[model samples]
Target: MSKFFTYLALGLLWLLHWLPLPAFVAIGRGLGWLLFWLAAPRRKVVRINLKLCFPHLSEAERERLAKDHFAMVARSFLERSILWFAPEARIRRLVRFKNQERFDALVGQPVILLAPHFVGLDWGGARIAMSYDCASMYAHQKNPILDKWLLHGRTRFGDQQLLSRQDGVRGIARALKAHRPFYYLPDMDYGPRDSIFVPFFGVQTATISGLPRLATLGRATVLPVVTRALPNGAGYEVEFGEPWTDYPTDDLEADTRRMNAEIERWVLTMPEQYYWVHKRFKTRPPGEPRIY
Candidate 1:
């Protein structure tokens, strides 16, 4: 039954990939409206996250943000079809790179494309994979059929070497030495291990201390990669921020804290595009009540 439904969804997505961008996003937003209601558990998760992170917002405002976020999440999910099935010229036209000079300045050097968990991450990843032979980590999907589909979508464009958690940091380090830009997204609660509680939106969030370590090990400069889904269904805009000057200084936790701070700044620009449905604060500090 699950396989049947997965195939059904995939078939629909494959067909819908041919639609124009505006129509594609309109359908995705409709799906988002349905998901906002149908996906009760995730809706609750988004609510809690918004409440925790944006305490300043009124309840009504937060509620609207949650709905908009669900729409973006749906669009982000459905839009992968464009990356997977669309032609190279089509994708290149869709994802526009802003301030490529920042990345271009550090050409021939090991670089880490630190992409935060925005709704448009896959879109951004596909864009980067077009030009650079990148190395990135991916989680195994439970269903083999869906996993295979995801793998194909990610690797279709460039020489992308996707590593699972089991591959360890060593694999990425080697890839960096090989000069493949690491399309790293290290923003999530991966339990208490190797994660230090850092201030994310004033909450002591358990963030992995891997970004600094990877930059140090790989000798890679960090460039913040932000992919924004343009309003009115224009297209995606991927902006690469200026490279950090003195990153990964003597302090490890401090470096991780700074990383979280950077992500907060980016999220402020487009809160709805951030990954609100994720249980980001699932593993709270010791003796603290569970968030999800």
Candidate 2:
């Protein structure tokens, strides 16, 4: 049954992939409009997230932002077919990199590409893998068929290694030490273990401390990378920032806080593009009420 559904979904994606970029953009927006109304639970989640993060915004402003966010999320979903199945040349043309030399200098060196949960994140990862042998971890989808397809799509270019989350830190560290940059997605809520409550948008958010630990273990430099979805189906731009100078300091908690703070800065630049539909504040501190 799972395989049947997975294939059915993939067939729809393949058909959508054949549409012109602009046409699909319109279709994706229409899908988002439907989802915003139909997926009431998810819409509520997005609303709560935006309210928590941007308290200064009026209710109307937050709602507008939520609507835009849903549109971007939907576009990213519909565009996955292009990222996963389109010709390599088409994918390359659709993604542009800024300050790529910063990334180029890190090749063959132990590095951690710290990517946040932005809408265009996969495009950034795909762009990086086009030139570098990188490693990253992924959570397995419930459907085995979809999981297999995702793994294949991500690793089809270059010598990319996508480890399962169950593979643990040791696996990722080993890959990084082997000179494969870890395309680390460090901004999700994965519970309290190995995580500390840090100030994210002034909220005590649970953030993972593994980033600094992994950097220390691999003796790697940490570089921040951000990808933005250009307006009007223009394309995506992946920007690689300078490597952190004094990261992974003696204070692990402080390092984790810094990580969250940096992500907050980026989110401020484009609030709608950040992954707000997620229950980021899902795991609350002891005795605190649930935000969701």
Candidate 3:
């Protein structure tokens, strides 16, 4: 039954891909509002995240932001059908690169493509995968069938290498030395083991120090990769921001904080598209209470 349901959901998504792009925006907004009401736990999480990050925003403003965020989340989920099954030409049509020459200029050198958790993050990664054989890591999903599909869709183009989390930093280091652009997703609360309590949006959030550590280990340059799901049905922009000059300095914590700071700046531009639904502040300081 689980397998059957998985296929059924995929089938629905496949059908959804055939619709006009505007329909995704409209349908996603309606579906997102429905989910905003129905998915209580997630709505709470989003609310908490927004409150922590945007402390200045009023209750009603955050309330509206949360609803709008769900719409982008739903739109991203629904658009996976287009990403997974659509032709290369169609996918290319939907996703474009800004400052692409900068990305191209980095060819043959190791780079850490630092992508943060935006609703359009996956689309940006997919855009990169369409052209380059990038390497990135993933936590394995519990369902084997779904896991297979996830990987299949991710690696369909560019022969990209999606290493399992267990592969560890060794896998990433090797990929970097190979001169492949490492498609790295940096800002996430992956617990407190290898993470340090860094100031994210002025909140002491558990942020992974892997970005600096890996860059230092791999001797790679760090590039900020941001994706904006353009308003309406125009398309998505996978923008490669200017490379950091003095990154991975002696201070690991400070480096990670810089990463968080950059992400926070970008998040302000499109607050709704940021991945606020995640329990980013779930891991608190030793004496501190949980934020979620």
Candidate 4:
């Protein structure tokens, strides 16, 4: 039954992708809002996340944001699918990078590209790697078929995909030394493995510290970048933030805290766009029991 539904969903999605861009965009936007209100599991998750993060917000306000979030998520879903299936010419027309040379200059250097869970950031990474050497570290999705398809689509532009866990510390280090840019989404909460609790939207959250440690150890520059959703069904803004040249200290924990702080600042700038549905504070702080 599950497999049947999966194929049916995929078939419909393919048909949607085949439609004219404007039509697909309209349908996708509508579907996102529909799912936001109609899907029980998604609504529950969104509600829980919102309630936890914005305790001060009225229930009505949180519900409104959750609805907007669903719309954005739905739009992102269609946009990303289009990103995969859309032709190069159309994709190029969709998103543009400012200060691309800053990225261009690092074509030969080992660097960590920190992308928060913003719109089209993955698309921006793919575009950047087309002209330079780059690889991205992503949490492997559980569905084997979807994972395989995603891997093929992402690497179609020449960027390598590094599975977050399987790649291990050594593999990532090797990729760094190769002197090509590495892409990592900074907002994911993987586990309690060497992470530090940092203030994210005034809530203490556990975050992955691998990027800063790798940058400091490998002597690589860490550049903060975000791809924002643009108005209309067009492209997005691939804005590059200031690069981290100073690097973190030898203390792994201190460096990790600093990295989390930086990522938190970026997410706060665009609270609605960040993947708030994720249980970021799932991992409990020391001495506390698990909450979710």
Candidate 5:
């Protein structure tokens, strides 16, 4: 039954991919409107996250932002078929890189492409993998058939490698040592095991400290990467910022805070594009209440 549903969904995505850009955008917005009204659980999560992050905004303002966010999220989901299964030339034309030289300079060095969870994140990864062999970690899906398809779609370009989260950091470290850049998405709540309570939008959020540790282990440089979905189906822009001069400092907690601060800055630039549907503050510190 699960396999049947998965195939049906995949078939729809394949058909959607054939639509023109404007038609795709229109359909995605319609779907997002439906979801905003129908998906109560996810809408509540987004509302909670926005309220926690932006206390200054009035209730009505936050609600407006939440609606816009839902629209972008739906658009990202529908457009992913292009990234996953579209022709190489089509994907190439759709994703543009802002600072290609900065990324090109890290050819032989251990590097981490620190990408936050923006709506166009997967598109950013696909754009990078078009030219470089990068490594990234992915959570396994329960459905085996879906998992295999995801793994194949993400790594089909540039001989990229996708490591399972269960494989531990050793695979990523090895890939880094072999001079492949790590496409590290380090902005999620993975519990409080190796995470420390840090100030994210003035909230004590549990953020993973593995980023600094991984960089230290691989002796890699950290470069911030951001992707923006252009308006009117103009395509995506993947911008690679300058490498951090002094990162992974002696203070792991401080380093994690700095990482969160950077993500906050980016989120402010485009609040709608940031991944707000996630329960980021789910893992609270001891003696504290859950935000979600």
Candidate 6:
């Protein structure tokens, strides 16, 4: 099934690349509607996540957040598609940087650039690769056409791409050894072994341990970054936070928990912007039922 989707994605990539800019955006919007409004996989997932995260919010508020989440998802998809095919000048014009010099200072050092799953995340990753040799891990989409197209777009700025389930540590080590920054979405669930249960949105949720592991192995500075969508529905603000000074203890589980907690802290700053579509609480700890 994955192979079949790969083939389909390849075809879509061909069609999308050849299409005019407006046409590409049209196609993107259509796909967004299907996935976000009609099919609504992410919206459904987010609704469950929101209910868990904001239990105190009224039913009407939860419903509003769910609807807003879907709209944000749709807007993000279309803007990302535009980034894929748009000219470099156009992309630069749309995406602005705030407090980026701090990030620039860490270029030579092995850095674990942490980014939330926001609207312009791919573009932010691309911007990093363009400035410095960088590698990022992306979850493989079921649609082959979409996956290939996404990889093609991500690698366009000369950064290598790694699948999430691949030898993530090894790939990251190679990038670090070469003094290239390694990027990954630390908020999502990886698997039972690769993750640890941590407090998120007032519940213990499973989160990938890659950030802590990578930071420890490479002695990398963990920098939190977020790319927020602007009101015009076209531009972005790529904001970078200060690096984490605290190091993990000898215990892996404790360190993982600390790392996930830091991520949760930053994510709540713009809770509405989080990629709530993810099944964040998919893997519960022993004796606990899955939250979603």
Backbone clash pairs in model 6 (N, Cα, C under 3 Å; residues 3+ apart or in different chains), count: 5
User: What is the number of backbone collisions in each predicted candidate, taken in the order shown?
Assistant: 0, 0, 0, 1, 0, 5
Candidate 4, residues 193-225, lDDT tens digits: the string is 867787666667787777777787677888888
Per residue, candidate 2 scores C-alpha lDDT tens digits across 1-292 of 5668779999999888877677767887888889999999999999999988999999999999998888889988888888788888998888899999998888889999999999999889888888788899888887788888888878889998878888888898789879988899989899988889999999898888989899888899999999998878888899998899888899999999989988998899899999998999999999998887
State the C-alpha lDDT per candidate: 0.91, 0.89, 0.89, 0.72, 0.90, 0.71
lDDT for each residue of candidate 1 in 123-230, tens digit (9 for 90 to 100): 898988888778899899999989999999999987899988998898998889998888889999898998999999999999999999999998889999999999
What local lDDT does model 4 show for residue 43? 82
TM-score of each candidate?
0.98, 0.97, 0.98, 0.88, 0.97, 0.83
TM-score of 4: 0.88
Q: Please give the lDDT score at residue 257 for candidate 6.
A: 73
Give me the overall lDDT of model 6: 0.71
Candidate 1 accuracy as TM-score: 0.98
Error of 4 at 121 (Å): 3.2
Worst 10 residues of 3 by lDDT: 145-154
Residue 24 accuracy (lDDT) in model 4 = 50
Worst lDDT run of 10 residues, candidate 5, spans 19-28
Write model 6 residue lDDT over 1-292, tens digit each, in one string: 5777656744555455444334534454556546666765666788788888889988889877766666566655645555576667766766778899988888888887888777568768766666666777777887666777788788877646564656657777877777777776777776687767777777887777777778888888888887876653556678888877776456777777776666667666666667888787788889986565
In candidate 5, which residue ranges exceed 4 Å CA deviation? Answer: none
How do the residues 1-292 of candidate 3 rate in per-residue lDDT, one tens digit apiece? 4999989988898898788777899999999999999999999999998888889999999999999999999998998888878888888998889999888888899999999899988888888998888999887788887787788778888879888888888899899999989999878888988999989888898898999999999999999999999989788999989998898899988898899999988898899999988898889999997676
Which pairs of residues clash in candidate 3, taking residues 3 or more apart in a chain or in different chains? none
Top model by lDDT, which number? 1
RMSD of each: 1.0, 1.1, 1.0, 2.5, 1.1, 3.8
Q: Residue 246 of candidate 1: its Cα lDDT? A: 98
